[model samples]
Target chain A: MSRPRLTFLESSLPYAVNAARLIVMDRGMFVADFFLATTVPFLMQFLIWSYLYQGSSISRSFGVLSLSQTLFYYAFSIAFGRLNNGYDVVSNLSLNVREGTLEPHLLRPVPYPLQKLADFMGGGVVYSVPIILVLAVFVFIPPVALNSFFWPGWVLLVVVSQILCFTLSWTVAMMSLWLVRTDFALSLLTTSAAFFGGELLPPYLWPEWLRPLMSYNPFRFMISAPAQAIVTMDGGFVMTALAWTSFYAIAFGCLSAFLWRQGMKRYRGAGG
Target chain B: MKKYLLFFRLGLAVELAYPVDFIGYVFTTLFVHLTRFLFLNGVFDLTSTLEGWTRRDVMVAFIFSVLLSSVVDSFTPSIRTFVRYAHTGRLEPYLVQPLDARWVMIARWIRPGSLFIFAIIAPIAMLTLSNLNVHPTLLQAVGGLFALVIGAIVNIAVMATWSLTTLVSKRDLPTEFIFRQVMRLNQLPPSLFGYKALTALVIFLPIVLTSTVPAMVVARGEYFLLAPMLGAAVLVMILFMISFRMTMRVFDGSGG
Candidate 1:
């Protein structure tokens, strides 16, 4: 019997359904997990920054307009930071590779890397959307002021940046293919990304000598670019931000594909 | 004690087998700490102090927090693996051993690798002391040592409590989640929080005893708090032991 060739939509349906099912089944766990993962870190950052500004003049430093403005910056940064979670892809790939399960996956209908990417994006869709919507609500509320020039293009830029964030994280995770032991590399990447990505502190507040390093750094494109777009509505910065983000997205995507191909040639599975 | 030494040697050998991994880990730890130092520098640049805490005072407290965290990390891998053993019904070997199962489990997973954290801790501690305008007396140093020792015990007891919960539930306890919360809270100096929050941390969380109290003792010569902190650590240790025994009893009697 001949089986019908499944279209892209048809093949993607199963992965999408699986993702949606996991979301429904683990709804409560997701809430708590997201709270602990996103909220706690956000609150800790707020606490630290508040203490820094405490008993000091309440004026701007690092281009932040006010304390409330600074808090808003950190609050959304953490929310956007959610898109950078790549632990699952790294752990799952390394475990499969080590256990020799990846050999079977290689023979499956869908490309193995695509399957993994689909899974990553599926989970991302579930986690990042609601949080973004909630932040948008807060940004529009009375106390929290957006830049006067805020427009639809700003939201589109954020969405594109988030997609770039996911691709870059996945590419970084693909380094597991070469290292085999991804734990060390994964932590190193994540720690560096969080620091350089400006999740810890804004890059403007970064040391003057370090500013050149941060300006050219792709990691800054992932975090600070979108943030700048949201806050400063300057046309020139927005164009540059979009350009760098799209450039990295394409660059890392090609790198990841190249690495996967090279890694597959070198792979000899662990025998059971 | 001999068995523990033997286990420690074996653990060190295992960790040292992967030289690249070890070096990478050490550097990552140093880098993480460096970022923290930078964060504090950024803050102190803007203001003279954080809620009345000078740079040296905060630095001392930060080192204590890192030290306590390292101690916990050193021991909890074994505790987590032990929980996995229980989950998979592979705990029979430990149960059949002549020694106490809890003690054996605790001794099994001590990674000598974490001892390297002190490599950073030592130099930072010295720098912090030298940076201090007030010269600490020998008595304050001795009192601080006592507080640190007692604080380590309290932390161990807290870990054991969480590890024991895995046995009772026959599943993994989210020890990492709890540990993260504790570490973040401990990073804050006790002075920053209100009296009620500080009291809650002291009695309930007890991480305050680990870093904040000891840092206070050493930096400000607050020796008066040492007696109560030691007393609290002892009480927590006793409670932990009792809880472990009861949890083991339940595990032994259950078919699962």
Candidate 2:
């Protein structure tokens, strides 16, 4: 009798399940992460914006968004920010490279990047539940309402942006193969994303000179585009964002492949 | 004190050996702070004032926040090492040292790269203050500096207490993540949260003492704020000491 052969999906499913299981097991850390990463930041933004928009002739609306809409933007962005986060990918890859753990992964039949992607998706599954719950509160709770038609576009952008975020993170992580340490690189990447991705401030509020950079950055696709899709309810914007995100995702995917190939040439493993 | 100085010197020497890493650290710190400043600029453009906090006042608060963060970042490695030692039962060496065990645990290691944050940000801070026309009196200057020092102590005590949780929980919960997020609250004036939240933060968490009070003391010549800041610092320090003793008593070292 011949042994059964597993397809790509079959092989990858376990990695995702294992990653999700680990996240579920670490309930304490996950809760803390959700609260600190999403809830607290949103609260801070709420207080700041509420105080700023309090008594003014500006009529509650700043640029394209009213105060409540702006709050919803932040609530969605912060939650989706955590949902699409790639820090674990960077940390895990760097640790593997440093410890020469890549040797085993290379020997495995499956591609290393696919394995990592599977793991990333698995962890994201665990995070997406709470993120959806949080967004539900923002959408269903009074004082903030969203058009039902925008939900499909919002979901499409989020799905595409996750791929873009993962690819960008993977590309950045490949640099650890050549660098002595990646702590600085990690910090730079995180700050740049937060600043340029409209996490800290909306694109409408950005200075005119910074408009080009703010519009074209990969992080904008990952963070601001999806948030805007729901709040702005513009089909054209969502389609444009989806197209750009797909372009960046493919570009980064190719770049990551090229870097990994070149890095493997320099890979001497533990003994070298 | 001499031993601590020696440890600091050794850490500095090690940091100096990696000049490239130090430069990268400085650049990254600058980028982070500059972006934060720009974000504040965007906010100020929308409104002239936020809850009576002018752009200049917020800038002052931001500088103080940076100082507090720098101090905590410098000591972060020591806190991590203490947590690791607690888990691995490797704390015996520090315990056997002639120095106080608690001090040894918290001050044995340092990341000297973090000290460069001061050099990088101080000039920028000074320029921003000058642009705001914030010149403190001599006495106000002294009080501001005192408040900053106490603020750092309170921040460190809070982190130390958080790290001590590893002994009781037996899990290396990502205390650094929580610490960093909590520290984010200091980036703005606590008063923006209103009086009730400010009182709660001061009494329970005391994070307001880390930056807001010091900024007010320096920028607005509010010397009366120092008394509450000092009191909070002393109270937090006592709490840290108590937690440290109790946690250490229960620590049956998990084998390294």
- Write down the TM-score of every candidate: 0.84, 0.91
DockQ-based class of model 2: medium
Which residue pairs of candidate 2 clash?
A: none
Over 4 Å off, model 2: A142-150, A270-272, B84-101, B252-256
lDDT by residue (tens digit), candidate 2, A1-272: 99798899998899899999987887877887787667777877888888777777366457878888888888877777777778778877876776677778877767999999989888888988766885677667764555566668778778888888899999989877776456666777777777878888888787889878887899988888888877767878888898999999999999999998998898776621
Give one digit per residue, the lDDT tens place, for model 1 in B11-80.
7886787677677767777787676677667666666666777878877877776776666667766776
Q: List the residue pairs that clash in candidate 1.
A: none
**Error of model 2, residue A215, in angstroms:** 2.5
Model 1, position A180: C-alpha lDDT score: 59
Candidate 1 chain A weakest ten by summed lDDT: A56-65
lDDT of 2 by residue, B42-74 (tens): 888888877777888888988878876777778
Off-target runs (Cα >4 Å) in candidate 1 are: A16-20, A52-55, A59-62, A133-137, A143-163, A224-228, A231-239, B83-99, B104-107, B131-134, B154-178, B224-256
- Docking quality (DockQ) of candidate 2: 0.56
| Every candidate's lDDT | 0.69, 0.79
Question: Could you give the C-alpha RMSD of every candidate to the true structure, in order shown?
Answer: 4.0, 2.8
